[model samples]
Target: MNPRLKHLVVALSLSLLAAVFTPAHSADTKKADAAAVVQLQQRMDAAEKHYRDAMLAEDEDAAATATTSALAEMKAVVDACTKQRGCAVDTMLTTYERLLKATPQFDDGMPAADEDPLDERDFTAANVPDTANAASLLSEDGQRFVKMVQFNPAVQAGIRRWLTDMRPSLMDSYENYRYMQAQMAPAFKQHGLPEALLFGIMAKESNGKVHVGSRAGAVGPLQFMPATGRRFGLGNDGSGFDTRYDPKASADAAAQYLSERMAQLNNSIELSLAGYNGGEGRALRVFRDTGGRSFWDPDVYNQFPAETKDYVPMVIAAAWLFLHPKEYGIRWPSVSSRPSTITLAQPASLYELTICLGNWGSRDGYLRALRNLNPRWAADDMLPAGTSLNATFRISWLYRFNCAHGQRMALAKQLMASNVQSALVRVGEPTPAGSPQVAVATPAPSAAAAVPERKPAKPVKARHYKVKRGDTMSEIVRKFDCDLGDLAQANKLRKPRYALKPGQSLKLEGCKG
Candidate 1:
């Protein structure tokens, strides 16, 4: 061959060789990518199935375990993908999106021990687990739980978008969770109630909201209804402590109350839960009429109210989630074991502590720790000498002025008390809407009134509005910004939600009020 032709021929051969290898390498990459996609898809499906099972289960511990297992697997797949050089994690992302959109919503409103499941099963009044419920499999493993639940690409993306579009409070304060937990151990310990049990209770009771209250009059971190609370050592302490609002005191009371209920109800968590909500007298009465069988018996379980039936499972479900977060794919929460609260000899104010700490942030975590430790602190509490505080004391972090819990409590005894009353329920006296209100009178001259026989400043016309079926007088007043008391007076209606006939007319008097 000619020299030029030979060189060109060699170049052509080299180019051909490079082209031949390209497809082979591409095939290898594609095969790996395809496998990765399959794995991601499998993980997403598993996560969904596990979460559903956990939610319906009444055995929270079991549910939690299952949830943890589910998430652990999911995380393994994700971790592998993260390591892949040419990974198209988009499939994982897509799977997440598909599942989040496809799966049924778990909790749109706050969760509660008495809340009904999204779906019911073979469970019936006759067959429902006496206190059965559900939880997710992803809840078991901490890492998997976070990937599947908290940071699931699809669900989290959607959650982020939804939250951005409509502002709402989704994040929480550990203070509320801790307060609930602290209260649980002390109170239940006396009655042989397990400390771990508190996590489930607090999760369901208030979703960790300290200032929570139900329309039925339940209040505080534990959702103790006023009447029930008063009966169970939860209210009106001699020292001006409303036990319902006092974490330590209330927890102590709750433990005692739960123990009594459990024993009275034959040591059945299901039956005890029923008693907690449906009233002990009623639950027992129902059981008495029946064969007095176990809670899991459909016949025995059905004896309780709908709320009671639902309550048992929810508690168990929440507990399961706590124990096995992997099943639901929630984040691996590494909460330090809550420290024991040590009491001081004298009261110390939070403000004083903050000041004494020297340059603590107004909303710093340390201050939050103080509040969590002593939830009963009113704005003006004189954290009395011997007052208890929950803390993880570390002298190396910051010391000198701040002593160990014991010494600090002793010093606090000399400080003036705080103003706790000022810290009473932030949400108070719900205002009713859409009721008629009377306006303050701007009286015209008496002489002018006499001339026109007092054409009484547009003799406020009483307008007639139909009362919706669920309408409450308070609701009506709130809608209309009317005084509830005035609405009752004007309507001469005895009942606050005066059995409004659909065509009922609510008369607003004076100046078209």
Candidate 2:
């Protein structure tokens, strides 16, 4: 063999080895590039998510500023990647551009430090409205109300108290007022009265709680006394239910009552409000004696008691806040006030409904709204199937989603069916020791044993008893030693709140007399 031929063979083998290893190394480099692209994409997604979360911050100005900064930082990262070799710059730049275009404009006005007292700390009884600067903080409209109400030191004090110490009560009133505005406000509007005046009176009277009753027999949202309520058709509605508890009825009565007072008091709103808080008779007598003087007139104001003096100013202050909350840096949370109706698909109470309809879009559940809208029904009353109820659109949506038929509905039903009586242990029962407690089944009495030998009582003819004023069925049953269930069944009386009327006759049952 020639020496040159041997050398050429070795050279060919070396060339083949180089060709094989070069392709393998190129494949590894491609895999590394693909992995780098995935890592870059993930980082971009995380940055976009951070920006979105920052946009939802409660402080509008801070949210806008943070979102803009986040977007700019993301853009810089894309530009840096674009200058690097083998980087997926085209895809990353496209994502960055899309995010920039979709970002909201940052034009929110800065909020004052004192504008959001609630956000400064968790809401507690201790940290309330700071009224030291209330006069300076008053909105233009609030100041106007002050002038109209004869801005005295007492009235200014009332405004400050409502703005700071009683702020939660004010917010609650606004929330409740939103639900009943459709029903109650129209009555005031028809009578040519400001709706804010109605809200103010209602807030002061009951904080928009429809079922509230004063110790003096004043009832409903407006706190009308029994006699005054009767004067305006707010007494019993003949269904064993009082119209004084009805928001719409009470609002109408309040409108009529206020209108009458204004007419009698020479159309002076202050005097009319005074007459509302005090007696109309006293208000008229004072106005007549003063010869049509202002309620703020020292002589005219001195005639009223301390309560009336405080009442007039407090109501005015509440009305002022209702008209101009934003001026005081108060932002009433937006509620879905669109009204809707819901017919119970089955027998369920307000309590059951509230449990099933979890708070999806609200801070608290919908029990208060339900009670306010349907004041006729008690919270625990099991409404008859097909009963119609007034509810908000959000509540209706939740009802359809959770209360219609699902685990939520089933759980709610199970909760409603629960009875403490069923779980009650005998008072004298002993606790089991060192063993799992077992339920014992009571033996059924034999048929013959169950049927007790009966002895008939001497016949005492049944008699009818006349129901006196303020007599409840239970009281009458106890007085006569009658079997309550038997007496109710005999008179066709309903259970749990048997309706009775004066001079109505009830036949005695299971009585010895």
Candidate 3:
């Protein structure tokens, strides 16, 4: 062949070879990529499922964690694609969009249709205004108070929001507030403040939950920050319990704080609420800068944070509802607020009690009510026998019928005792023999060989006891008839404040028959 033709022939053969092999190699790579995409998609689906499950469980913290993890996984897939050739960005993007679409969208202030409706009749009987006239609902003082507070479009919108989308939360706040009214209202009354104001602030602050603490280090039903709480005599009470968590104490402090703010701001409740939600210093500064102008004054209002602006109006709206529920067609559920006490006949936790009590008269179970009334005790705390807890008359009645030593109580106890760990076995491990099978020399037939009577093992009384579920130090001391002081000393426990955990061992010092 001619040299030029030979060279052309060689080049064409090489090009054809490249064309044939390149596609085969590309196909293998594409297959691997496809598998990888499928695996990543499966992970994303699993993470999305976990997030949905957590949200449905009402576990906001868990849902947040799951979201973070899922986002990280999606980012990993994206990063992996960037490092590889021929990665279908559109495919990955589509997968990402699908994963995001799987997340359920939650509408703020919206309740499910099947969600139990709040029994508004409770608040209606006591708080519903007579005559349905706004004027008739107000006293001379209330009239003046209302005039001082702004009821502009913003406030009206807040009221509508509360009555509509936020109705469930509003009702929940009312129910919780009623239980604490006896404890909180007197403080406001003593300060010559309206009780409605107290309820309004509480509804906005912690939803009337006494033990709630805010992210800003504010603690208790009133959501007082640490420094502010200390200023109002609401910090530690020498018993490791913050007085801020005490409904009466916190309410008294809140009343005092409000009174002080009112004094500084011409007794304007709006400015006072602004100060309560926004920083008091900022409210005071704005008030001084505006030369004691109204909180609704654009100049002064704009100075406060968005939260405070929303807060002042919402609080007023809630207070308005508290005073004029009938006009608005709001009927608060008539909860059994009559106070009572129940002494546990046997060991039980609040969880067990709530289960056995059954929601006979109440809408939900008595767990929240019980927990609110007894904030010092945890819901899962295994209460000792004979532990007397503060409760309502309704709870007392339910306890008598359901929780006082019967089939229900037994079932609850049995349920509480179920050990999932005991049921779980090692996946591939063989079960161990019950008794070691060993052969022994047979000297048993000797006539004189009577195994020396195992001197009846002298009954060794237990000198120490391991704490069991539902065991408390007080109950333990009582059970063993031990002196409290000596028992505490023996166990190195603090006096009058001993806590016992399951599996903890305690010495029976000074325990006598």
Candidate 4:
């Protein structure tokens, strides 16, 4: 009986030990599974980081192709974990997705390319100024860096609305604003000027169109009436290089001039800008008469004149935009317009460069850039050699590589000789001009393309009339509120009847004082 009981107790004890050890083994297996998942995640994270870093490097284009590889690798990790381990790693996936979206987001929708071209290397380094000596070079060549900003929500929305109302052409106008700011702001700031001032000038001068000029002889981004431009050291470099129209150069002058006025006026940007637009002496005289009061003080401010009042507000508003682009709802461009100096030992015309654009497989982009980079070259001019282009761009390595060893010269030859008249071939279809089959062919008469010079914008003439009652004519003249025949005869109405309707309309074709 004792032997039977002892044997039973020993067997029960062994069974209990087996049960405990079995549960412990299962726990160890579960811990190992968790550890493996964590390890796989770490590996995936490392890969993601590598891709992320690569995306942030000296040349962003390198990441364009690598982007797909990184995405695939990440997806592989997620697939492996979800399928093999049944792991629910929502957080990891989100982090990876965000990295994918954010890596190449332009700085304020503009390239963060290093302003100090000398210091920049391949990828990962910020484009901020680094060296002390760069300032002298900056001053000499003049910095023409344009960084696009969100600006402010109000201004952006207003501009978008105004442009949308005008026409689709305004879409490019909006882009021009962004691009002009990018080209101008750097020089503006470098000279201790506010970026909004540029916007203000653009608003009054060209409505933000970079190519526009004033009939009063103002030209370029700021519409520097040629005399005023020369007074401010802005000139054509004696070769049709209208520096006033150069976003960088004009911005440089505008900033310096504005800064001087501001300092003279005791940091009053309003007064300073008023003087810049109207006349400094006039602004100062107005200030003196107002007992040196604040610009916003209605009593004296109103006396300054309507144009001044409107101008001051415009400057302030534009300045507000510079500081807060996103607030204005303005979406800046993804490209930077900072001036880059690539030495061309020889002069090269923009037209000649277009021909060599065959090297780039197309000249559309180069041709388009000419209006900004080399303003002197008419659209059709055979680029005379040795032209120093002030391109409104922070040219990347891609352009430099394309134009190595005077390759631009050959390109210029082609650009001059190539016909622009072939009715610009559709994109993706290579033009016969550059097609391998017809590479050496000369331009035919039909292919003779002329780069059209933008004609001076026609001035709009408005009619003035005095209110009159019951004045009707077979042809109603819209001036002086008189009979069409009487008014037309007064001016020189060529039309037998300058057809008119009854109302407050001009009674003559031309009303003179």
Candidate 5:
């Protein structure tokens, strides 16, 4: 044993014995002992430092030995503290936290500070338990989910779709889910549900976009209806923020809902999924009517609506692909998603932060990650300084080095402050030669200044716009930020289908900018 570790063991043993045998002590004596406990904490820190050094030096033998010594020391410290009076155990827990922070990236054969932690790994080391080999990296529940897959023609067809045209969506869902895995996966795990199942449901429902809403009135990554969401405690929290749009809360509700369905539906995943998509009442009725037959039984399957029929197989296929992406020649993007946070040094919006972050070490910017992690804030909402934003380790790091007091930061600020209305020029306005085209709003005259009589400004008239190729009425309305009814009325376009053809002329009214 190392001399420092041996000293830690002896100190802990003496402390435990004293705590057990001694009946009482003065306040001063207790305070003195607490101080001694604090001193003992240094040993654990030293052990961690040794472990980190060994890992950094690529001495696996030394690193393994240090790990064993450190864990034993931690256990002993915890044990002694439980018995020892006035031994502030928080000191010990903080030491353990530091060890955890250091240990996660090292177990994957990389240095703690330098490695991204997501490259060529199933999950962060902290997430996977007792992972002896690469194949065992999937949590026990994940393996169970893989075994549950029935691989029928519907699932096979779904898999073919995922591998072909839908491949981009599959990749995007994986990337989005990875960032939110820390927030969402644990709920399913706590309910003894599979993490892959959560991913599958999220992928099929919203492609892991938390704010996504369906035309059918379903919302969030899980696509819960308003009634179902309210049942699962996912509605408004009274501050106007819908909890369904919240990843962690929605995932918890989803897990609980699934657990209830599993209990009522005889633990049948397919039937539970059908209930989730079609209707729980319908699913229960079908199951009871079929004498608890397999979901594949035509009697049970035919009862579900066409949408539910397609939904179940697609979700299953996505889950299958999530677990076996490599088997089908699909290489998912490597994402660094270790949970971290950043306290804003100055007010900024997600859009500004995304611009400043500038896609460093990512194919796309961090806007999606920011939105998914901090769901309450809109992309363009400027969060105040000292606001703590949930982020990834890599993103926080980028914010520190790239986003603080840089040219890119200034540019981001400038871009967000700009207004498109300032750039617009009326069709009949005279062009002034040698005048700068930039439109600057003049400041209003001071209240105390002598005011001159001013003529009333003319009301701006409707502008004429030509219909372009491939332009739909809805698209044109959205592009011009026009009210649909007002736009239709101004252009004399028909109701319901306000159709348009190429090269047609129309008046742009009820539009801003």
Candidate 6:
């Protein structure tokens, strides 16, 4: 318990006791006796303990549960206090507010509780969208989109996985998607594809994490391979920025790819998705060889690799869950994600922005949102003043209020400027007479003391390193503590994916070592 919270709680207890024994109380007025007061205090303390324990253990689900339980307990206490004639309800309400402030707002990583998992309507009604009366729940386009796909046991399994073990991932996906919906969803809508379908592919591909790069050379929110991405107008834009990492561009490309596949595969969403995961050439060959049979058919399904078999259903399942989250007891956190932009007030990095933003209206803060929106900028890169950044309306407001100029902003700047090297203690070193002394703990020598004359230092010469197998540009730069831009320029390497070959010698310029 926080010391302030403890003091507040004690004050609340005293106020309650005073209220209970007050002589000013009317004779007929109901008063909570000593025993009832003790029980209420115990409940409050127990709820707080449970919440603290869950948080300390980092059990996200348990913490969420405890938070809910604590809030409920506080509400019940407030209600009970209201009914008591002489109870200091204001003090109780203040205590509740303190508890609310004390509780940690866990991010989307925490899965919400699922209610009745045995609901027949969720699965049965899923088969037919029109008859399910989903019009009230979904858009006209959404309803039409759901009707295009058939639900089966495989999809049901996918749904089960999402609702159970993958619930946190699903929640994270939804949260990430919400911030990007304005940028990405319109591309799908223009292509006459469902937003849910776009979400499904993104969720399955990268869980809506924009900068994700796979071991197979696939990159971005939609996980596009370099060769394939180029085919769909996704690649480096000659500005060191990969368009494949751009949510809008990648979503547009995915929509176009899916549309092309649908046109060839008899308008089957499953077949189109299969073409996406498995090679398009293979899916096309399989479709023709199997006489254009359904994707679920044994011959057509077995034609794909095991990955595609899982991929198709999982994508569909994610899509279904996106459309029917409430049916599975998933109440997605409301996001104020209306699109807006903020021009930088001063030079600052994304890390500094994240720190200053302080999670005012969001659980996780604006780091992911900033990364997804501005894929061109690295988290630590300092953007020049007046540079416009893609952000939500809430984030823009937060930026104005908290990030512009404040103690928080100053703190964020200080934190970003901090270096791990400052904490390092060099061992087995006695400073040479002419060597520069670091200003850590050693006291400055007296001005009167004779200082040894030092020879002029030579200009730092450029160093070279041979690229080894499995070495990437990021790894090489980090290994030498080199400036990426400088190293790339020196080596005549392209931006974004700085393609390095084995045994290739790289000129290490502007490196610390």
TM-scores, each model vs. reference: 0.39, 0.59, 0.57, 0.45, 0.63, 0.65
Model 6, 278-391: lDDT tens digits are 999999999999999999999899889999999999999988877776677676665656566889999887889999887755778889999999888777666889999988
Residues 337-418, candidate 2: write the lDDT tens digits. Answer: 5566788888887879999987655567788899889987766567878999988655775676567666777787677655
Best by lDDT: 6
Write one digit per residue (lDDT tens) for candidate 3, span 249-287: 899999999999999988989999999999889999999
Which runs of model 2 end up more than 4 angstroms from their true locations? Answer: 1-148, 424-513
Q: How close is candidate 5 to the true structure, as a TM-score?
A: 0.63
Stretch of 10 with least lDDT, candidate 1: 392-401
- What overall lDDT, based on C-alpha atoms, would model 5 receive against the true structure? 0.76
Which 10-residue span in candidate 4 carries the lowest summed lDDT?
Answer: 140-149
lDDT (Cα) of model 1: 0.50
Candidate 2 similarity to native, TM-score: 0.59
Segments in model 4 whose C-alpha atoms lie over 4 Å from true places? 1-174, 177-183, 207-210, 304-306, 336-368, 384-513
Separately for all candidates shown, the number of backbone clashes (residues 3 or more apart, or on different chains) is: 95, 0, 10, 57, 0, 0
Model 4: per-residue lDDT, tens digit, 231-291? 7899757654567767678877878777778777766766786787778888788787877
Q: What are the per-residue Cα lDDT tens digits for candidate 1 across 298-405?
A: 787766777776556555444444444334443322122223344443345564565444322112334445554555553333455666565432111122224333
Q: Name every residue pair that clashes in candidate 2.
A: none
Off by over 4 Å in 3: 1-145, 425-513
Q: Stretches of candidate 6 above 4 Å error?
A: 1-137, 424-508, 511-513
